[model samples]
Target: MTVFDLPARLDATNAPAIEQQLLRLIQTDKPALLVCNFAATDYISSAGLRILLLAAKTLRQQGAELQLRQMQPAVADVFRLAGLHGVLNIQN
Candidate 1:
């Protein structure tokens, strides 16, 4: 299992870094657990959710897993509203 420290802001400005990190994590040979912390972020835009959705897809392909933990409510709402709560496993 590996932990990922999400940026303070994960909007349009950080999309590239997020995508790169997601790819890097997927390259691992073993099944992985990616714990993402979004507490530093007050809110996330659709762009941020887009990145997470992509990461979830990658994790599925690799037979690994990704989770959102230590997330603030404002940000969690992003996932909920997107109907992603059932898709992404979140732990707090």
Candidate 2:
């Protein structure tokens, strides 16, 4: 499985980088493990969250696995606040 290791910060400044990495992995003709790191990210806006949703949706369509892990309490709260905790599987 492929693992997409994300940085602590994933704001607009590095969204493109994350986008590129995600797109590259999803297009691959094999299963993958996307372990996103958000431990240092204290904030995430709607647009930023959209990136995760998009990635997960795309991966699902492509029959790949995307697992998010080590999410900061603040960041996980963002998912709960946005009502996406159930939509995406954020490792505990």
Top-TM-score candidate index: 1
lDDT on C-alpha atoms for all candidate structures: 0.81, 0.76
Report RMSD (Å) for each prediction in the order shown.
1.6, 1.9
lDDT (C-alpha) at residue 68 in model 2: 79
Q: Which stretches of candidate 2 lie over 4 Å from their true place?
A: none
User: At residue 84, what lDDT does model 2 achieve?
Assistant: 89
Candidate 1's residue-wise lDDT over 15-61, tens digit each? 87888877776675444777777768777878888888888788887
Which residue segments of model 1 deviate by more than 4 Å? 28-31
TM-scores, all candidates, are 0.87, 0.82
Instruction: Specify the highest-lDDT model's number.
Output: 1
Tell me the deviation in Å of residue 86 in model 1.
Answer: 1.0
| Model 1: worst 10 consecutive residues (lDDT sum) | 22-31
